[model samples]
Target: MEVYLVRHTETVCEKGICYGQSDVPIAAPYLEIFESIKKQLPQDAIVYSSPLVRCSQLASYLSNTIIKDDRLMEMNFGNWEMKNWDAISPDEFTPWMNDFVNVSVPNGESFVELYNRVNDFLENDFQHNTSKAVVIVAHAGVIRSILCKISGLPLKDAFNNKVGFGAVIKIVL
Candidate 1:
């Protein structure tokens, strides 16, 4: 299967805000951006998206029937959600900063947990699907996790994939 992992476009939130799983909307002037992204994808592929509005909006525009899955959500930042990163207490993120791959945020999940859940979706839902091509509209973290899983990268180095907003990455499974 050819799976295209597409990150949602920029959000309305300003930089440094931790908006994970917060259902933020896409930035303004998204129509042109969405159009460009649409040009890169297969027109008749099975499409999946996070329930978050940012991703759902893009998915809705790209596919007539988009499958909204909770598994595709960005990592839940827990107490950090919707807070500016600089405003957050440094002490609060110290442990997670030290070992984010293994450490769960306060009331949130670890990268391991996100990886596992995404893996479950891939294993059970995606793998069993019959479509020759699939499109996944989700967050950077989810796209990075999928890239790491498919490319044999360590969770700690997931950032290396550089999943820019509205970017499309196609991988075969």
Candidate 2:
């Protein structure tokens, strides 16, 4: 199977904001970008997306019937929702910084947790689907987790991967 993993377009949130799993809007005039990415997709690809508007907007361009999946959502940040990364106290982020390779956020999910969800999705697709190509519209964290799964990279390296708005990574499984 061929998979096209796509990150959502630029969001309304400003830079440095921690927006995982947050329901945020995409910036206006993103139609051009969406159309451009849509053109790159295989015509018969099944499109799936996180329920968040940021991802939904982009997914809608490729297919009106976007399969919304909670499993594809970003890692939940809970109380850290909408807060800037710098605004979080060092104590709040320090533990994660040190142990995020395994540790989860308070009242939230971890990279490993997100990976399990993504893996389940992959398993279902890999086992039951016959489509030669599929498109997944998701968050940077979700995309990173899948890439880590495919590349055998550690969660710490997920922080260093750059998955930009409208970027698409192809994987053959």
Candidate 3:
């Protein structure tokens, strides 16, 4: 099976802000970027996207039929959503930074939780249809989790996979 993982274009949030699962809008002038991304994908492939507006906007532009999945959403930052990273007290942020894979945010999920849900989506929703190509429009975390699962990379090292905004990666499963 061929899978195309596409990260949404840049969001309106500033660099220091944590907008995880906040339903932020994409930056302006995204049509051109969407066009570029579309050129790299198969128009006939089944398309799935995060329910977030950022991913949904791009996915809709690429395909008329888009399946929105919550599993494709980014990590839920809970209380940290929309807050500047620096503003999060070191006391709370340091622990998560030290072991994000295992540490959950105040009211949010740990990276492992996100990975588990993403894995479930793959096993239950994706794996059954292996004959056709799949296009997944999602967040960086979701894309990284899929990459880690396919490559047998440890979840802790998922950051090593640099998923830039609007980046499209193709993988054969």
- Top TM-score prediction, candidate number: 3
* TM-score result, candidate 1: 0.97
Per-model C-alpha RMSD:
1.0, 1.5, 0.9
**For residues 42-155, could you state the per-residue lDDT of candidate 1 as single tens digits?**
999899999999999999999999998999999999999999888878788888888999999889999999999999899888745576589999999999999999899999
Please provide, for model 2 over 59-160, each residue's C-alpha lDDT reduced to its tens digit, 9 standing for 90 to 100.
Answer: 888886778988899989877889999988888799888877677887887778888888898787433456558889999888998889888888788867
Ten-residue stretch with the least lDDT total in model 1: 123-132
lDDT of each: 0.91, 0.85, 0.95
Q: What is the lDDT of candidate 3?
A: 0.95
TM-score of each prediction: 0.97, 0.93, 0.98
Stretches of model 3 off by over 4 angstroms after superposition: none
lDDT for 89 (candidate 2): 83
Weakest ten-residue segment in model 3 by summed lDDT: 124-133
Identify the runs in model 2 with alpha carbons over 4 angstroms from their true place.
125-128
